[model samples]
Target: MPIRVDLLALEPNVPGRACLTVKKWQGGEEQLEFSIQRNQDGFYLQDQKAWSNNPFWFKVSRFALAASGEALEAQVGPEVVDPLLEGGANSQFQIELREQNLGHADKGVVRPGVGLLPSTAGGQTRSTYGGVDLSAPVVPEPEAEIPELPELFLPVAEPEPEPTPAPAEPVYTPPPAPVKKSKKGLIALLIVVLLLLAAGIGYWFYQRTPAPAPTVAAPAPAATNAEACTLDSMNSVPELTFVQTCIKAAPDSAKLLEIINQAKASKHCGVAQRLYANRAQAGDPLIANAYAREYDPKYLKASECFPTADNATAAYWYETILAQDPNNAEAKQRFEELQK
Candidate 1:
């Protein structure tokens, strides 16, 4: 039986942070999860299982990684297959790898070791401020000189004769005292008037208020969540959500085909791509071939959801089919064409 490889998720921003699930069916089923990272030389596969300790490094050229396979071994070497098969090297063992969104990985850079090295400390001590004269001597400023003023002569007049002083008594006047009035009765009357006014306003408002209307029950929501999971229903946002939920629920091949047809008719490229990918990853050669054609240079269409044709991606899907059924003449021919 062939090994199954499925790409789970890939980080677009950090392309090296990709996860995959690999399963093999020979000699009792066994599966392993791995986190893939790229370095200068090639790719690194680290087993995600806690108990797994072996990590393998594949030279970039070995796996045709630039064109096809996700984690499959190249025809030349058993280095990749041996580790994956856990020493059960059946001559017939083959791996079908499915990947998506691998174009996000940046161009390779040279990191000479497995995994990422811790960032090194700063190389040299450097001053934060630049071009300062710290050694210059301090200079004292000179004080301003004062000039002497020449003396001037002036005449002084004699004081006027003293006038006779007369003492006048201050006029006696007393300020009027403020009058005090009793306000207890007035305050009490004002309080009583305010209370009466408030009571009258309250009574008026109470009489003017209208009675509550009878409660009319709302009609049932017409089982919106149960709306037929058709592609046409995708136009409704709520129904779209329901459709997505059902897609994830893993509908049968027939249901998937129905949805795929609806998607193509509606020009729902993204939905079609998703359905094709899901089915293709499940070892469905027919679905895989259909998906590969979507990216194939010859059959690809700009009007489809995939506006851009990618020969590399088409080759990858074709390689996946070939791995499963080596005698698939169509996949083999198209794969060779894409390679050239």
Candidate 2:
């Protein structure tokens, strides 16, 4: 049966989230309900339980909002619509069509090319002196002569000596100005002596101060996840929450593997999913392949964690593995088979 999706409600006022109801057209009275929350890149599925029973369930890679007529619609996926139907069933939804529309004046018109030409001719013209007459005689101007003047004799007169005036009294001599002695150098030397005394007192106090006594720090107890939850607690409390936290808190891969094996033996199916998922996303090919098997159609029938198979999810994880290790034959084969 084809799947049907209906929009129930948009988040109040802000429109940050959308609630949707989905169901198979002829499947039964059963229906799936979930919410999608907006993120920076797009939107992500918030309710996993909505499609938990769907064998063809897959991750929506992207979502975009669109307006159709008067109503708004969310276009989701470039994913396979139906896993059972291969080839042409694979498609993507685009919100709107972008067309290159040219205006009436812009259509089929070619602009003319402009060529530059010189404003004046390039050849040289005749010089200005070329028009003047050069054939005239070269005449030189004559020098003029001046007349000489006669010499005249003049007599010298002798003057009589007058009485010498008395010498003026010597001006009173003023006493030399008193010399003032500078005290700047003396003051500077005193300041230096005071600084030295201060330094000596500081050294004396430092010498009298005794060194701190040596002490030892007590050793810390070895840290372990046992404090969070234990296998024994599983039988008593059986709380999945604590078990998951303990699984994440397990120190190394070896410890994590130990916890996963024990959890499986105790029939704790979902505990290992998050544990393996964390490492898979961190780019571990082996862990990613193991995580993929949890949803793989070939293996899900036997899995306690997943009752129904999801080829899309398994294919997604397989593709993740291939991205990191392209030569991985298992992941490549599984991904191709899922596509078919």
Query: Could you say which candidate leads in TM-score?
Result: 1
Q: State, as a TM-score between 0 and 1, how close model 2 is to the true structure.
A: 0.34
Clashes of 2: 0
- For model 2, the superposed segments whose C-alpha errors exceed 4 Å read 1-223, 226-230, 233-250, 299-301
Candidate 2 structure quality by residue, lDDT tens digits, 170-275: 5654533331122455466668767776777677767767898588797756325565445665555434344434544544666666665566667765455545
* Candidate 1, poorest ten consecutive residues by summed lDDT: 108-117
Please, what is the whole-model Cα lDDT of each candidate in the order they appear?
Answer: 0.44, 0.41
Error of 1 at 240 (Å): 7.2
TM-score for each candidate, following the candidate numbering: 0.37, 0.34
